[model samples]
Target chain A: MSVTKKDVNYVADLARLKLSEEETESLANDMNQILDYMTTLEELDTSDVEPLEHVIDLEYRLRDDKAKEPLSHEDALKNAPDADTDYFRVPRVIE
Target chain B: MSSSVNDNYEAVIGLEVHAQLLTESKAFAPVSTEFGGSPNTQVSPLCLGHPGTLPVLNENLVRYIIKMGLATNCDIARKSIFARKNYFYPDLPKGYQISQYDTPICHDGHIDITTDGVDKKIGITRIHMEEDAGKSIHDQDPFNTLIDLNRAGVPLIEIVSEPDIRSAKEAYEYLKRIKQIVQYLEICDGNMEEGSLRCDANVSVRPKGREEFGTRTELKNMNSFRNVERAIDFEIERQIELIESGGKVVQQTLLWDANKMETRMMRSKEEAHDYRYFPEPDIPPVVVTDEMLEDIKEELPEMPDVRKQRFIDEFDMSDDDAQTLTEDRYLADFYEEVLLHAGNPKAVSNLILTEVLRTLNDRSIGIKEFPISEERLAGLVQLREDDKINSSAMTEIYNAMLEEEKTAEELAKEMNLVQVSDTDFLEPIVDEVIEQHPDEVERYRNGKKGLIGFFIGQVMQRSQGKANPEMVREMISDRLEQE
Candidate 1:
């Protein structure tokens, strides 16, 4: 159940983060400690317990399929960090 | 190009199809789901993945997926949950797509496809409901990819097939059937070029007798049904050639370069589907009740296969004609509606198969958009059946009817295209034809019976295509014998 340096590095890479060596080492140690603390709950045997899917027991609330007007194109792109007038722009991506 | 490698090996194929549901609203948001809005005009806070916004499930989305599941003979799960498949792309503004992971809404269905007169059943692995990502236009911008969130949160159903398809042709048949079923259900538009429907293929090859499979590559970006077949065929040949030349087939994603007619390697992502799927906490588990299933089943339109068989049995339609007529639900509905007005299924079928279909092709319109009403088309068919118009005359009247907005009878007379069935009228034309072509008449009486056609042609031409050839034939024979 130990979080290894490789695991931290892989996850950080997926998140597009470039952590320094010290930060990576610290994240690995912190994740390991958290896993170690959570392992204490495993000592209690609950083989017959049903897995809980949700904290609340309520079913999903559904809305009728009627459509409402969406935000204006201008408003939709207002908060975009990088955008042209009509589009939210990002670094060039290929398939 | 050679058959040697192909003969020694066989390819296995499975298709994953994504069909955008035609719900009025987005899958989880209450915003419009219309296609091709001025970029981002269809986006809401939830669609844009703004903080503090939550999604409410759309009722029609569930109903439509259930209709599709029933149409495809899939078992609808009593309880289905949405899972978040985490990924990072500009198109995926949420950084995760809400999809069904472990328990798909429908499973264990089978679609029967016929290829070259041989029927094979391809097993459906699963059909799950999901939300679509935004549109990323890479070619439209030089420095940055443009994103249109209008497509984000649009409802989609992913239909995955078992690795049961044997060849590219079978895959094609299977895809055609999938398209037909979805279109029939009216759950989706089933348009591939417009991206309402999309497909990807998983391809692998093995020796004919080998039970195990080779490494498979995934193919994406095929925009049409033809491209799907061609891509699979090209991938199969490429894999076989690689193995033939002592190269190993690697499992990776390739893009179908339709212009080049070859598959090229897609730039590999940081990780292959490193999507860590988890249960979506926002949407509570959905429970499909028995009453819901019953309602969906009752409302499910008759699927293409069943309707096709019924057409064959009920109307005495040939298999090819039946297949063509039932290819689209609207077209089949138009045929049946015409039959309500016209007697003689064979005649109506012929008219639809030839003239009506030609108009549809030439105009590039669907039956729903066809200009001629069922009543008018039925009237045209009846005229031919009643020997009032020859086939060519019927065609002329049909073509003229396209723009005039007049009934078939009104246009028939206006265009002088009706057959002159009266013996009294045709006899004069027959007399003129016989008197002018005495050599042909003499030859006809001397047992050159085939010259009757020449005489009939002359009479029709003289009458300006108005004389009934059958009546003219009978009178000419009697006159020739008597004279």
Candidate 2:
């Protein structure tokens, strides 16, 4: 499949990115090149090989179901761009 | 339009339910997963997506999911991987949710639900584990949307159902069964109102006998079971109307306005997220051992269907009573405990169905907070069985028991509500009533047979409601016949 400018713009919209015309053109070209390079893997013949989900073969590391101390309210909102006494405030978000 | 015209199409529905696991801590972080704490007080650095923080899986989360899988007859995957679903939302601290994409933990499960006296099996496509985002309260602030990260990093399991539901009623049954199973497994509280359990439905409609499905719309924001059914019904009608008007059904994401009872489009299919999924590098794939599966299987409680069948076979209960009793786990247990003491299943079931449930509703308390002990309730039932109290006296004693710590017998004695079956004690009252109500007696002799109720009422009043009604009726009938 070929990457098109419309597809790039649509993706950018979903990602909440404001892309200019020049940037959209360059990103579309970059995506096409990446797709072309990925097609090289289609030539490899490994019909019997199982698809890999993770690179490292490791078992899950699990912790007990215990609660630890969480951050205080003051520390939790320390880095908020905007906040009230307890909540992290953002510009009104409506669907 | 006529009913026949609306019946020309069939609606196809499938539901996706997200159940928040009742684990003590968040999915990956050590922050508390308790609900309704102060805002942001339950967040850890990892939950906030601070740099240099790594996630570790909670052991109970996996066990809880496996328990659900076994209960629902799911094929548990031996190896499951977590993937990062890239998205941007204010509630998502990490800007991407750690979820399962291709390798879900459970798959190929089927749950049987009975709707309209017909049992149908809804196929489960998959159950994947994921982390919940924080809450955004838009109504709390006038100018801003307030975010609470306490719910972030909470563990959740998304159960995806195959498109097998044929109507809104069937969808309702499917959701109820799912909630019952989760509550029985003790993994989720199954409170849709509290947001612990959430459902989103995909709905489509097609001409009758058509095989190819129409474009489907995804519906969200239904907070209750009734709303789920209502929304599906409204959407089906809307789609059918759209199709009949020469307009095609567009694939979109719609939010159900519960008050308005209509669905409004949130976004179309083109605006759907790609969710560029990749394996989460911070956590490793979960490997289920045979021993672990066996242990979880051993821990599985008796499911609702099996308990319902057992109640029918063992207790000789009616199908409806068994179903009503087994709908809630605690209620079923209470019924069983009463059975152990009362030894009469039908009677016990009747009492619970009427008096116990009425009291519960009147006081607005759950069965757990009910004041009457199971043993005391059984004792009351036993008293009625032994003819120590009549039905009215039984009700009075029950209401009294709710107020104070007194036995049924003690309450019966204190309130002078015991049944007086002895002939000598009731004969005088019967004779006096017969002598005093001479006109009624003559009318009774003239075959006004219904006056027996009035005579019984007088005798009961004179005896302070302690007269055994059956005995009084027999004695009074015998004396009147002597004339």
Candidate 3:
């Protein structure tokens, strides 16, 4: 199976990825290749195979529910491109 | 007014709670789940849904969910499956969300939430594991938005409940009970403001005694417990009005505008088939052994409900008081420590629940951050119990304890809060008060019984608040009778 040009654009639109034409074609090819590889599982013919939820069936490990200090305003806004004195700055949100 | 309240319409409420598991690592990858981190810094290749990247389950998350299942008395499935829920969003780097579909790890549970002298069981249909989507900030602009992947791939357990709730108050109690359970299990932080735990309510109204269900509206983005209750109440009323006015209640998803205090339609509700789900083939199926289950079961702590009941039976505290004390593990532990120190659970519960809790609430403080140690609180209760300090003096010492670091005993001693319990010590002061207040004494002698309290106050004023009221009252009454 292979991804058509339409399939490439559809996935890019769904994921909101601003993909160039070349990038789209390349990703489509790569995903098709991966999907092709996954087709090997069909040969196993294990219809009754059960899926696993957890690797280990352990019960409870709990942390002390104590309140701790949160990050400072500056630290919290470290990654934001724009920040105000106490908040991360953004444009007007409402009309 | 909601038609449910006016007419014979019964509101059916179900809650979908998404609790971010308190794991140090992300759900599908080993990235740190710490809050307020740099955006996209913690995202691994799998979380970003990069090509050729596969998700590996975080072992700690599974253990946490199992612990919750056991605490809630649910059946833990020996097998379960992870399916990809296909959706498109900028923050969801993975075009589809990797979540549990049909088979969940836990199923068929019930939580009994008691409120207003009524016990009601809210049925939990399933608790399934899933990865959280990153946050979308629409404040950037009306037409533009920014994405923060810091919360992406955080492990979460979605506890979906049956529509067993009847009112907004019942919904609040159910959510509160769930928060306590998760917090007690040490699985989730249960902080609604931080988005660690969130509540989504599916509300509908049916004519009373009708077997058919009403169309439901989903309410989301509740930042606090009060908002959850308020939004549901408003939506229920809105739907009831629409239905009563000969309009059909359309099923849709709504975002709660906390500032506006109204629910705005976000999108039409999607059915199960809308998100095309298929088993994720990248990850292999997980299998567990009986030995592992037994080992995990052994590590379970005594749950909140069991501990609350035990407090009532063991400490002989009233059910209402016991429930309040045992609601939080830290407060419960503090109360237990006070009992250990004072050897009087009854007095300890009263002081902690009534005095300590009231003070904490008044200051908007949490018990985990309470400054006074349990041993010190026990000292205050002991002083009052032993008549070392009168009740009036106890409040003064309590304040001093907060402002300073002295033990309750030391402060009571230093501030002269020791009660003058001896009538011999008090009789002299009482005589002085009577001699000074001759007019009042005459009025009391002329059959004014209420003036006895005034004479007692005079004695207390001469001795400060340290004089025991009972002893001073007896001395003054005897002296007046003799006169």
Highest lDDT model number: 2
- lDDT per residue (tens digit) for residues A1-95 in model 2: 99899999888887789999999999999999999988898788879898776677766668998999899889999998999998999999874
> How much is the lDDT of residue B465 in candidate 2?
89
Residue pairs of candidate 3 with colliding backbone atoms: A52-B286, A59-B296
Q: Which prediction has more favorable DockQ, 1 or 3?
A: 1
What TM-score, to 2 decimal places, does chain A of model 1 have? 0.80
- Candidate 2: regions farther than 4 A off: A1-42, B267-270, B360-366, B369-371, B401-414, B421-424, B439-452, B477-483
Candidate 2 C-alpha lDDT tens digits along B1-483: 557867999889999999999999999988899988988999998888889999999999899999988888899999988999998888998989999998899999999999999989999999999999999999988888999999999999999999999999999999999999998999998888878999999999988999999999999999999999999999999998888889999888899998888999885554456889999988888999999999999999999989999999998888998999999888899999988899888888999999999988898677888899999999999998988898899999999999999899999999998899999899888989988999999999999999999999999999988888998888889888887
Candidate 1 has an lDDT of 0.89
Instruction: Give the winner by TM-score.
Output: 1
Encode model 3's per-residue lDDT on B1-483: one tens digit a residue.
733364778788999999999888787776778898755556655655668876778777778888888777789987677889988666676788989888888899989898788998889999998989987777644554656666888889999998999999999999999999888888997889888889999999988899988999888899999999899888878888888789999888899999999999985433323576877665555444587689889989888878989988898878889789889877888888888889778878877877788889988878877888888888889888888888879889988898888898899889987888876778788778888888888988899989998987887888888899988888888888996
**Local distance difference test, each candidate:** 0.89, 0.91, 0.80
* Pairs that clash in candidate 2: none
Candidate 3 Cα outliers beyond 4 Å, as residue runs: A1-95, B1-6, B38-54, B140-144, B267-273, B421-427, B439-451, B477-483
| TM-scores, all models, native as reference | 0.95, 0.91, 0.80
Backbone clash pairs for candidate 1 read none
List ranges where model 1 is wrong by over 4 Å. A18-26, B361-365
Residue range B125-195, candidate 1, lDDT tens digits: 89999999998898988888999888999999999999999898998899889889988988888889998
